[model samples]
Target: MCDQCISTVAASAGSRRRRLWDLPHQCHCPLVGVCFPLSTLRQLVNKALGGKAMADDYEVHVGAVSECLQRNRLSELLQKDLESRYASTVQAFRAAKTTKELAGLWADAVRRGDVAGAFWAALTHPRCDEVLQEVVLRDMHMLQHQAGAAIRVDIGKFNLLLREHGVLARELGKAQQRCTQLLAEKSAEIEQLNSQLVQQRAATIGKETRIAFLLQDLQQLRASLPDYENTSRLRKQLEQLAHRQAELETQNAQLRQQLGQAQRALSLRGPEDAPALASEPQQDPIKEAPITLHLGKKTVLCVGGRNGNLAHYREVIERAGGQFAHHDGGLENHQGALDAVLGAADLVICQTGCISHNAYWRVKDFCKRHGKQCVFVENPSTSSLSRSLQQIAQVP
Candidate 1:
């Protein structure tokens, strides 16, 4: 028998909360291992030996278990640490009024996988008996053997998971590389599309400029044709219409003067004279004024036409009672000043054949953005402008 066995033999039976020294000799080894970690055992043994170090962990554990067999420095330290560590568990066990109840708590604690705290608490419980102590010790011994087998099984599972993690990490790296490659390809495709769009826009502008030149050349060629019978006939009809318009205007003026004289004469006469005037043949009411261009106060801006024809353009606008402004469509004037001119005018007449492509688009975009009335004329002629103004007048 060892010192712990001798102590167990000498120990008296008691029905009270026992200290570590009062526990069975067999209980000491398991209790020391279960209730305390190796590091703590080392510390307690170092403290008990007064700073004298042990050769190995086993020796330290042995020393702690041996000290726990009696009242000593290591045992006291362990008692204090366990109480502090398992304070809540100790308080819970204190609720047990009988040994059978305390044993039930220990069994429940074992099923719940908390034997460390429950073991210490139950063994040191006030109602704990020798039979209850032996049962707890037996349960703890079987639990240790079961725990060793579980640790080996867990190690195998852990190794399998670690291998799976490595495979997943490699696949994730490959996926990221593929995504980056696809992004680079998409960026290249977008760049190509943008380049194509810019080229197409330039080509479109070139074609428009060519078409304008062709139209202007065609107009010049038609003007040079002296034998064009249609032109001569139209000119003659225009002269005849002008002459007839002048005669009608003169006749309207004479009629208005005569009606004014008659109204004055009637006003001067009495009520009896009004009846004689009614019996006389009544003169026809004057005809309503002919539909004509009337711009009121709105300004008309003419952009890009023959410089010599600018006076003709102004004359037509002013005759229609509209304010007139003009820009040379970036030919001689600054292109930057066009925006300000466009902003101030209420209407715009764009001579497409007479202007640069840049000026044409600038004027068109400005008119579109400001919601200005813009008339695009292919022929930059006085007759065309007059007809455009006449059309504007006819709109409701």
Candidate 2:
């Protein structure tokens, strides 16, 4: 027995010693000389021998026995407590101080069928508790670090996306500005084109109006103009007729005056001279011709006489007591003829149709330069020739 066992036995023996004083047997041993009931003696021996041996050599032996008895008593008490307070005892074991103590409690709870106490004992061991706490803390820190890294990565990606969007927006703005500039340029071009079209249309309308006016004037001129040859010939014939009529009138007037003078002379003469004039029947007044008076001769020259009709036209001039001359040639020869006629003739007539435009112009220019009368004649037929002869006789 140990000190705990000895102390328990000694307490029981002391209570019983007061009830029984004398022993029934006596022993020769000095350590234990008295003997009584076997149960009582054994109790007394346990009390006296426990922890009383204080030798250094017996110290371990004594501690062993005391520990054995204490464990036996603890096992019995725990068995009874486990049925009622098993949960509380398990919780208390979780707060145990050492790995050994926790293991012992766990074994006791298992033998007594305390399931909760066994679980707590396993988890609350000193080494297991430290390792579990370290593992849990390490995992939590890893998770926090991973979460922070993920957040940083997301932020970086968001910034990149924002930068790209900004670039795109700038490009889009530039494109829009270019489009606006192009549209403005196109609008200006369109306006210029429209203005040009308006100017062109106005010019076309003005041209059309001028053409219409010219056409109307041309139509009026065509409606009024006689044939060129006929007009020229008629003008010439009228001039000739007027000249012949004037000559006839002058002759008639002279004749009338002469008759009156002769009658006066016959009356003034004596009776004998009157009888002599009566023998001639008064000079036969009806049959007598009037005296013709001579005047200074006038000459007219005709140029460009291709048909050689100038001789026939001379009859009209001779009746008027005037002379006529002509020069026949091409334009160059005609120009020389014009110069000669200008020097010799009082009047010059140039036929125009036989010449080109340049020759006609030259002839007209020559006449104007010399201050000569020039008559232009186109084609002449027999009727036109007769009319031209009449006009020449009647020329003023």
- The Cα error of candidate 2 at residue 375, in Å, is 25
Clashing pairs in 2: 2-66, 236-391, 237-387, 239-391, 239-394, 240-390, 240-391, 240-394, 243-394
**Residue 232 lDDT in model 1?**
53
Lowest-scoring 10 consecutive residues by lDDT in candidate 1? 5-14
> Which candidate has the highest lDDT of all?
1
**Residue 182 displacement (Å), model 2:** 3.7
Clash pairs, model 1 backbone: none
| Candidate 2 Cα outliers beyond 4 Å, as residue runs | 1-162, 228-304, 307-396
Model 1's lDDT to the true fold?
Answer: 0.82
Model 2, residue 258: C-alpha shift (Å): 41
TM-score between model 1 and native: 0.46
